[model samples]
Every structure is written in C-alpha cells, then in structure tokens.
Target chain A: MLIQRLAIIGVGLIGGSLARALKRANAVGEVIGCGRNINNLQQAVELGVIDRYDTNPAQAVTEADMIVVAVPLGTIASVFAAIRDNLSAQAIITDVGSAKATVVADARQHLGNYLPRFVPGHPIAGTEKSGVAASFAELFEQHRVILTPLQETDPQAVATVSTMWTQTGAEVIEMSVTHHDEVLAATSHLPHILAYSLVDTLAKMAERTEIFRFAAGGFRDFTRIASSDPQMWHDICLANQQAILQILDSFKTDLTQLITAIQQNDSQYIATVFSRAKSARDKFCG
Target chain B: MLIQRLAIIGVGLIGGSLARALKRANAVGEVIGCGRNINNLQQAVELGVIDRYDTNPAQAVTEADMIVVAVPLGTIASVFAAIRDNLSAQAIITDVGSAKATVVADARQHLGNYLPRFVPGHPIAGTEKSGVAASFAELFEQHRVILTPLQETDPQAVATVSTMWTQTGAEVIEMSVTHHDEVLAATSHLPHILAYSLVDTLAKMAERTEIFRFAAGGFRDFTRIASSDPQMWHDICLANQQAILQILDSFKTDLTQLITAIQQNDSQYIATVFSRAKSARDKFCG
Candidate 1:
C-alpha cells in the first residue's frame, strides 16, 4: 500500500473523494476522516468513504503515514496547528486548498518542524455541489492537480504526495506557490467573483423576475458559477487577496475599454475584441 | 394560415429558425428568405427552412402579408428601408433585434407610414452557433419572446405578431420599448459583454495557455457566451448603449465594493454578497 494510514481533515467533497479513490485503488490501508461537522464525518464513514472518523485532528493523524488537509482557506492554519504535534515524522502532508500560497504560509506558521513534510497542493476539480455524499472515486480522473511545494519541503514528501494523486488518475504538476496563486486568481477566483457580482447586480434590478424569466441559455451558462459555495469563496478571496485584486483590476481595465468602444460607436474595436476572445477560447476550450 | 406569404430578412439562425417553427406549426402559407449572404439563403432554401429565396428585400416582401426583419441591430434600419416601399399597406412588420428602443427608432426613421405596422421584438433564444444550418424548429420552445410595440403601432399587428410567436411555442410578453431595453441591458447584453471582456483579458495574460488548461467547469460555463458572434454582439452593444452603460455602472459599483471587501479582509461582507447572489440565482434559475 502507498500509505499505512491515511488521515483526511475536513472530510467534505475533496477529502472524501480522495479517500474513496485511494480506497478503490487499494493505495491506502486505512482511511480516517476528521472534521468539525459530526454529521458529515459520520456520513463519510457510513458511506464507506472512510474506514473511521474522528473529531480531533491531532488524534486522527497520530498514526497516519499521510495526512491530507482538505479544509477551507480560512481554517488551514488551525488545521495545520491541530495536526502538527501528533504528525508522524515520516508522514507526508498535503492539502487540497484552492489558494496554495496562503496555505503554504499557514503551514510555515503552524507546522514549525513538520514544515518539511508539508507539500501544498490544489486539485483543479469539483462541482458546485459539496459534502461527502456528492463526492465519488472518479472525481479526480483526467483532472490536473497542482503541487506548490515550499522551499523547505522534502523532495520525497512531494514525490509521495504526487504519486498518491497520480494513482487517483490525476496528472500532477509542480509549480511555485506564488505562481499557483496568480494563475488561479485569474482563472478561477476572478471568474467566480464576476459571476456573483453580475448575478447580484441583475437580481437587484426593478424588472428582475422578467429579466430572469427571459434570460437565455447564454445568461444561464455565464452566471452558473454564481451558485457556488459562499463561505468557501469568501475564504478564497481573502486568502488570495493581492493576486485576485491585480487580476480584477486588469479585467476592469478591459471592461472599461469595451465600454468606451461601445459608447463611441466603435463597432470595429468591439468586433476586434470579441473576435480575438472567440478565437482564443475556441483554440483553448475546443 | 396566419399569413398568406411571410418574408424573413436576414435568414440566419433567428430568422431561419422562426421560419422552420412556423412551417412546422402550419402557421404560414409561404416563407421567403432574404439576406446579403447568398450561400446562407440558398442553404435555407435547400434545407426547406424557407419556400423561396431572394437577395432583394424589396422583391422578397412584395405581396407578403408579414415581414420579419432579423438582421444584425446595425443593419435593421437599412433592411426596413429596403422593404418599406414594396410592403403592402395591410402588411405587418416586425423585427427580432436585441435592442428595442433603437429598433423602434430605426423603424420610425426608415419605415415612414409603415412605422405604425412595425412591432419591435426580441426572442430570447439562440445558441452560440449561427447561420441557417444552425437553425432548428424547436429553438424557441419554452422561450420568452418580448415585444416592444410602438405607441403608434396597430393593436391588430401586435396581436397577430404575438399569436405567431405563440404558435412557435414561445411565451409572448409585451413591455414598453425603454423597459425592454433596460431589462435586456441588465440580463442579456451586460452578461455577454462581461463574458467577452473576461475572456479577452485572460487570453492576453502571459500564461494564457496554462490558465485556460487549468480553468475548471465554472470558468467554462462563465465564458461560454464569449464564443458568440462578434458582429452580432458589436451591434448589440452599440444599439443598447444607454441602458447597457447604466447597468454597467451599477455592476462596476458592486464590483468595487466586493474588491474593497476583499482588500480589507472583510470576510463577512464577502460572504454576505456571495450568499445573497447564490440565494438569488438558485431561487431564480432553479
């Protein structure tokens, strides 16, 4: 087995799905789930997503050969602190937080001597749904998992975590923690913020009901991400503040240019921007 | 039959789909397709989307009891001018433009006495795909069709046009020209512009290919409208400038507030906005 005992803190969609996938591949001997919500942890255990469940992170990771911190960004530091004292020296630590730089920083702050075993990671996979019941073994298949290992991280720890993700049918790639933050800020976080802002703006309009009633498939698709988890996104925005703000500024500048083009009746300018975006999207998304 | 001979100018997705739907419902005796693109009109004829094809709008609308102008917003006036002299006194004219106020203004400028017969409309239905070949009979199924009839417009013309859309399985609703423009500006035009702007901004990033590669399902859904027709969107942005600008300002304000909340580490504020948006979207979109 890849791991003698695998402990996952926060047993939600990401943690539960990883446990299930590892169990399915027989990559881990025993899976233990740790979370604040007893109901969720209980459900994970009852659903066979975890071999056992515990509320105390320190106790859960005491004998674990691997520990995965799969919690919200705001709770990362506390989770790291809770598991630090009991973590095995040989245990490889990783996480599935959306923002890697902050997670790495939180690990450095709380993990102390165990920092070398901590490999920051983010698996670029999930649905809008949450909780253990919504997770499955195939959740990570054909998906990309980015590992942003810190300077003090052990190479073997990174490799072990990478191999575990690979066993789940994920393509694992490594990058700097800062680079991961910047890339995700532009690709994921900014889009979610825009979706929420747009939906909120429209929902406040006087003719909101009719506006929504007549919204076509395009509008539905464009705002689908607005339906995502609020607290999770709230933590993400705070954790990756600088990178997200920079990207948001860039987007605002671009939007202002479009607004000016429309105001000036510059059809050519509008068409150029739209065509360029379409070509790029077609090339990449196709 | 609802009409003896119906002429459809600019027989692309909207026009061709309407023809097909009307034909399927046996609501029109004959359909004549008119457009600048000879290839698309010929294809529409071959596909039996229209009974006949003509390049000249004037010739196409001769003796036609109904004329549906479905060209790009920028070309609406010219199309109306082309068909005005040939239109029978008893014929009713309508358009499927995205912006209603501008369409109404254009009809007034070009249609002369026929302005009373012109009913401005926007059928909130379309795929990213365009042209006659992309048209389908069920494109308007369960879709909303907004008609913004002019004050001088005949009630009989409005009723007839509304009935025709209803026959094609669309729910017909009427609003004033300005109200339609404002609602559409908030719901449709603004979302499209945002999608195009976001896609354009990200495509110009240095790590663009990698960014697109890691973009999750949420990003794909949020930018799906960015793949829409460039020319069509350009015209829409121009035609609906005032209303769009108003809504854009509101969205910018909300976005600024969100950015401030994030920059200030106001997690509660961010969560409130996101939760509100999620609740609104789920209630409306579900």
Candidate 2:
C-alpha cells in the first residue's frame, strides 16, 4: 500500500475524494475521516470512503503515517495546530487549500518540527457542489494537481505526496508557494469574485426578472461559478487577499478601458481587446 | 409548408440554424441563402441548410414571401436596404439581431414601406463558435425567441414570425423594443464584456502563461463567452450602447464595493454577496 493509516481532517469534497481515489487504486490501507458533520462522516463510512470515523483531530491522526488537511483556508492554521502535537516525527503532512502562500506560512507557524514534512497542494478539480456525498473516485482523473513545497520541506516528503496524487490519476506539478497563490488569484479566485459581483449587480436591477428569463446558454455558462460555496469562497478571498486584489485591480483597469470604448463606440479598440481575448481563451482554456 | 419561399441574407450561424430547423420541421420550402462568402453559401446548400445560393441580396429576395436578415447588427441597415425594393409587397421580414431598438430604427430607415411587415426578433441561443459549419437544426430547441414588434407592425406578420420560431421548438415571447435592449444588455451583453475584459487583463499580465495554465473548470466556464466572435460583439456594443453602458455602470459599482470588501477583509459583506448570488443563480440559471 502507498499509504498506511491515512487520516483526512475536515473530510469534505476534497478530502473525501482523495480517500476514495486512493482506496480505489489499492494504494491506501486504512482511511479515517474527521469532520464537523456527524451524519456526513457516517455517510462516508457507509460508502467505503473511509474505514472509520473520528471526532477529535488528535485521535484521528494517531499513528497515521500520512495526514491530509482538507479544511477551508481560514481554518487551516487551527487545523495544523490541532494535529501537530499528535503526529509522529516520521509522519508527512499536506493540505488541499486553494491559496498556498498563507498555507505555507500557517504551516511554519503551527506545524512545529513537522514543517519539513509538510507539502502544500491545491488540486485544480471540483464541481460547484460540496461535501462528501458529491465526491467520487475518478474526480482527479485527467486533472492537474499543483504542489507547492517550501524551501525547508524535505524532498522525500514531496516525492511521497507526489506519488500519492499520481496514484489517483492526477498529473502532479510543482511550483513555488507564492507563484501558486498569485496564479490562482488571477485564474480561480478572481473569476469567482467577478461572477458573484456580476450576478449580485444583475439581481438588483429593475429588469432582474426579464433579464434572467431571457438569459441564454452563454449567460448560464458565464455565471455557472456563481453557484459555488459562498463560505469557501469567502475564506479564499480573505486568505489570498493581496494577490487577488492586485489581479482585481488590473481587471478593473482593462474593464474601464473597455467601457470607455463601448461608450465612445470605438469599434476598433473594442474589437482588438475582444479578438485578443478570444485568441488567448481558445488557445489556453477549454 | 408554413413558408413557400424563404430568403436568408448573410447566412451564418443564426440564419443557417434557422433554415435547418425549419426545413427539418417541413415548415419552409425553397430556402435561398445569400452571403459575402461564396464558399460558405455553397457549403450551406451542400449541407441542405439552404436549397439554393445567391450572391445578390436583391435577387435572393426576388419573389420570396419571407426574408430573414441574419447579418451583424452594424450591417442590418445595409442588408435591409439591399432587399427592400426587391421584396414582394406581401413579404414578411424578420431579423435575428441581439439588440432590438437599433434594429427597429434600422428597419424604419431602410425597409421603406415594409416597416409594417418587419418583425424585430432576438433568438436567445448560439454558442461561441460562429459560421454555418457550427450550425445545427437543434440549436433553438428548448430556447427562447423574443419578438419586439412595433405598434405599426402587422399582427399577421408577428404571428407568422412567432409560428416560424415555434416550429423550431423555441418558446416565443413578445416585449417592447426598449425593454428587450435593456434586459439583453444585463443578461447577455454585460456578461460578454466582463469575460472579454477579464481574459484580456490576464493575457496582458507578466504571469499570463502561469495564470492560464492553472485556470480550472470554473475559470474555463466563466470565460467561455470570451471566445465569441469579436466583430459581432463590437457591433452589439455600439448598437446597444445606452443599455449596455447603464448596466456596465451598475456592475462597476458592485465590483468596486467587492474590491473594498476584499481589501478590508470584510468577511460578512463578501459572504453575503456570494451567498445571495449563489441563491439567485441556482434559482434562475441552469
């Protein structure tokens, strides 16, 4: 087995999917889930996502060779602190948080001697849905998993985490913690912010009813991310505040230029921006 | 057949799809296509999207009982003028433009005495992909077709256009020309602007490669409309300038508020906006 006694703290969509995927690959011997929701934990056990369930973080990580911290970004520090004193010296630790610079800093502050064994990761896979019930074994198939290992982190620990993700059918990529945070801020976090803001703005308009009634496939696809978990996104915005704000500022500047072009009917300027964006989006995005 | 002779000017995605859907339903006979690209027109005929092809709009509309002007919004005036004198006196004319008020004005200026027979309609359908190659008979299935018929427009002409849309399996609704423009600005036009702006902003950043490389499903779905035809959108922005500018102002206000909330780390404000948007999006959009 690739992992013996794998403990998943805050076992929601990300953690549950990891456990299910590892178990399906026959790469994990024992899976223990810990979460705030008792019913969810019970459901996870019944579905074979975990071999057992625990309520205490200290007890969940007891003798676990590997521990996965899959909580929201705001709670990552506390989660790290809770299991720090309970982990074996040889144990390797990791997290699946979207923001990485803060996670790496939190690990430095709370992981104590286990800092070198901590490998931070963010899997670029998920639906708008949350919780254990929404997870599946093939969630990471053909997906990318980014790992951000700090300078003090052990190479062996990074390799172990990389192998674990590879076993789940994910392509593992490594980058600096700061780069991960900044890049994610531009791509994922900023899009969520824009989607939420646009939807809220439209909902408050006098033509809200008719606007939604006549919306087509394009608008639906454009706002699909607005249905994401608000609490999770709230934490993300605050955790990656600096990088997100920087990218958000850039977007606003470009938006201002676009609005001005539209107002003045500068067809050439507007077309240039739209054409460039179309080329980039078609080349890079799905 | 519901239409004996139908002429489609500027036969592209919208016009080709309409022709294909009507022919599939046996609702039209002797469909003739006209466009700047002779190869595209020939391909339309080969795919059975049209029964014949014509390079001249005036000749294409000769003796035709119904004509669908499916050109870009900026070209709508010229296309109307091209066929105005050649159309049969009893011919019913309609358009598939996204913006309605400008189209109504264009019809008034160029359609001559046929203004009463002009139906200003917008089919709430289409993908980012353009041209007849991407067109399909099922494109309008389960979609909406909004018809903004003026007071001077004949009820018989409106009924004929509505029946044509209905035969394509689309639900047809009628509204004022002004209302259609405003609502479309919020739901469709505004979203496209935001998407194009965001993609352009990221592409201009120094970290463009990394930003796009890490873009996940959410970003892909959020920016899908960024790949839409730039010329069409350029025409739309100018044609629907007033409404788009007004909605764009509202979006900017909300976005500025969101940026401030993120900067201050105001958890409650961010959460409220995201939550409200999630609920509204889940309730209204797919």
Candidate 3:
C-alpha cells in the first residue's frame, strides 16, 4: 500500500503545510489539492504544494490512494458525505481536525465498514498564522500527533496511516477517541478558549489600547493560540463543547482557589501552588 | 559623583544579574553584597557577582556610595531600617522590586526626606531560573526598565539611576508608581499567576503525568513562566493582591462568555473572538 497519489481536502495551514513537507521529502509521487476556493487551489498549485487542483471532492477522491480532510470540525460530516461514494476501496483517509470523537463517529456513520481505514489524528503543532501562504516544511517536526483509531480499525491500516505521519516527522501515539478529546480539552482546547476570552475581555476594558502595549512577553505567548483561525477554533469549541465545558469547570475551580488565596493573603498557599506547578513543569517540560 | 563603591542588598537573580552586567560593561569600581543567607552571599562572591560579601547590613551600606535593594517586597522596609542611620548621606539608593507603589511608600515612611533620592525601579526582564547561578550579563539588554518617580524625586538622582540602567542596555521609561502596578498587573503579574495556576491545575489532574509526557512545544512555552521562584511569586501575589484579583475577575467573565458560545454552538461568536484576539496579538506583539 504505497501512497503514490495523495489528495488533500481543505489545503489550509495544516493541510497545506503537510503537502509542502511531503513534497519536500518527496515521499509521495503525485499530490492533488481540493478546495472550495479556486484562488486558494490555484495559489496552492503555484506554491508547488500540489501537482494539481480540483474543485470537486468526488473527482479528487477517485484518483488518490490517500485523502486528508483538513477542514473545520463542523464540516467533517459533509466532507465525508461528499467523498463517500468516490473513495477507492483501498484509500486510507485521515484528518487533521482538533476534536476526535465526533469526527470518528461521523466517519463510522458515513463510511460504514471503511471506517476502519479512517485514522482520525491531530498534530499538536501550529503557528498564529493560517492559509497556504503560512505553510512550511517543518510545521510538524518534533510535534505530537495523536491518532484516534476506532475499535473496528484494522491493525494493518492503522500501521499504514502511522507510517504516513511518521514520514512527515510527527510522533504518532494511538489513543481512544474519547480519551483524545478529554485530554485535548484540558491541554489545548480550553487554553485557546481562555486566551480568546481574555483577549476579548481586555479589549473591552477602559484601558484596552494600553492593555496590549503593556502585555509582556508572557501575555503575548500565553495568548498566541488565540491567533488561530477563528472558523477552525469556533468549530472545535462547538464540536467538543461537552469536554471543553467539563475542563472549563475544573479550571474555574482551580482559578477560584487561587483567587481566594490572593484575597485572603495566604502567602503559604500561593507558594505551595507555585512550587508544585514549577516542579511539574520542570520535571516534565524541562 | 563617580560610583566608586556599590552595595547590593539581597543578592538573588536580579541583583546578581545586574552585578554581572555591570561588570561586563565596566561600570562599577567596587561591588559589595548583603544578604540573610551567608551561603548566597558566598555564592555571589564565588560567581564574581560581587567583589565582597557582607552579612552586616550596616557595614555594607556605610562603605558604599550607592545602594540597590534586591530583596523580597516585604523585606524592603527592613533593609531600609537596618541601614537607615548607617548610610552615607551622598549615597543614592534604588530598588529593583516588582511592585513600585508599596516600595515607594515604604521608602517614604522609612527614610523621610532622603526618599527624594530613593528611586523605585523595576527591570522588566527575567527567566524562570533564579539565584546567583542564573545571573547573566545580557539578561537586561533590549529590555524595559521602568522608573516610578514621585514629584519629590530629585532630577539628578533620577538621571543617575536612569544612566546606570541605560548603560546595561535597558530603555528606561518613567511612570507613576500606581500606574506601574496597574499596568504590570495586567502584563507581568497576572500572566505569571495564570501560568502557575494553569500548571497546578493540570498537574493535579488524574492523567496529567501521561498528558505531560506528550506535552508539545506550545505547552512548554505556555507554562514556562510557571517555573519561576515560588517564594518570589508568593510574595508578589500577596503584595499585589488587589490588582491581581480585579484582573482575575475580568478574565473569568470573558472565559464564561466563551464557554457559553461553545455550549450553544454559536460558531460566529467563537470565530469573532478568535479573530479579534489574533488581530490584537499580531498588532501588539508582532
């Protein structure tokens, strides 16, 4: 099962960057891009990210041995519906969506038995920028890519998808789709939501303009994820709302404790939290 | 007058780093260090961060032409009290404390009319690591050093302190002490608190060990500030409780809005927040 021909749906930052990286590695023989925007398709072709471009999802799916759906989470089902009948029997399709359970469920419903070959993955790598112009070869290097393979997934098929991602320089870890959503909701999804909300709240304040001017390097870095594509993040928040809400509740509890410590001038409690956090970050992230 | 002799109180990260940078720039004729910890004083001398170490605050202040208080916020008043009558009348004094208003207030009450020459300053630069070992010459270069000077502050004294910080490659900005705290609460203090709290929350999660194992670059960068000194952060949170609590309340409200949007599947609201945040970050932080 050599992935000689690859079709990338929604050739934006993640998808476009993957195509660019694959092309740079020359891992695949032919790459075709499919997108709703003709200008984007043309620009992707001009950028040499794809060898060809097509507006029709059906036509693109018919020729490729592998397909990557890189659209927002809300559109995952429609995307699958559009390509369901045209996908080759041997085609190994995957996605770069942030949420996993809902995407995997959609695949199971739409593609039926072929869902086994549908590897739902998320590469935990991105920049503040978006679109084909922002794509780069090293986008996924040394990044974690969690693959949520359904119980019905074939071992051989999972291995094939894992190999494809490995070639793109991502370290793939397999996890239950539900677990993936829960973990991401804690680590990635909730963080983005918090950053976005913080930005909005500060922007509405009386000193909004000066607020940004005073945002130190830490604030800038903490809020960097808020710069992600709005539509994409919006789709993720809605799609993974339950998990996100649960994580938010936990975060609020933690924040409330912190606030209480500060208000009560509990220096000891504050020190304990700071020490625990520092040690955890150093041991794991250092 | 030439700074033929200098005294630095509480030789930790800021004081030690300033000593290193001053040495590199060939600005000081002699450096004397004072601290409660005899081992830290010895380490500062061993690391060449000071020319001499003194456990007696009176002896350290009496022999120096200038003094820099680098101790914790709560300890600043005691540092002044220990050296109040022992100081040389010509000796210009400054502090590197994070909160300016409290220190300024302390200096006013403790030193009386001598307070006009006591400049309250903060170097807006640091790393998570601290102590004498973490001191480096280039730490303050290209960074901002804010001075909170009152109406009673002498112009010559301000100029001298400004010149010293400038020589170390920092751009000095003058502002009111209260304004400094307010701006910094949004910029530095709040961010550190949030980062530490976020890390603590994640660390306490059941599967955190595993989640951290897969923590990517973004997570590492986002939580980097959490690894700062626990005692330092504890003192800061207690000293700057009012502003921090106000900002935290605002942050919570914004977070609630985002959670609501996600729950309702309001893609438009989510995208708007993300886009606005992205634009704000790019405009201010780019």
Q: What is candidate 2's CAPRI-style docking category based on DockQ?
A: high
lDDT of 3 at A226: 68
The reply for model 1, stretches above 4 Å from the true place, is none
lDDT of 2 by residue, B43-160 (tens): 9988889999889999999989999999999999999988888989889999999999989999989988999999999899999999999999999999999999999999999999
What is the Å distance of residue B28 in model 1 from its true position?
2.2
Q: Residue B162 CA error for candidate 1 (Å)?
A: 1.3
Best by TM-score: 2
lDDT of 2 by residue, A13-81 (tens): 999999999998999999999988899999999988999989889899999999999999989998898
Alpha-carbon local distance difference test for all models: 0.90, 0.92, 0.84
**Of the candidates numbered 1 and 3, which has the greater DockQ value?**
1
Off by over 4 Å in 2: none
lDDT of 3 by residue, A1-286 (tens): 2478999999999999999888777788898999899999999999999889889888988868889999878888988989988988888889999998789778978987678778888998887678999999899988878888877788887887788778889898989878888888878876677677777777677877876776666777777776777778888887788888898888889989989988888878888899999999999988
Runs in model 3 lying further than 4 Å from the true structure: A24-26
State each candidate's chain A TM-score.
Answer: 0.98, 0.98, 0.96
* Candidate 2 to truth, TM: 0.99
DockQ for every model, please. Answer: 0.80, 0.89, 0.67
- Candidate 2 or 1, higher lDDT: 2
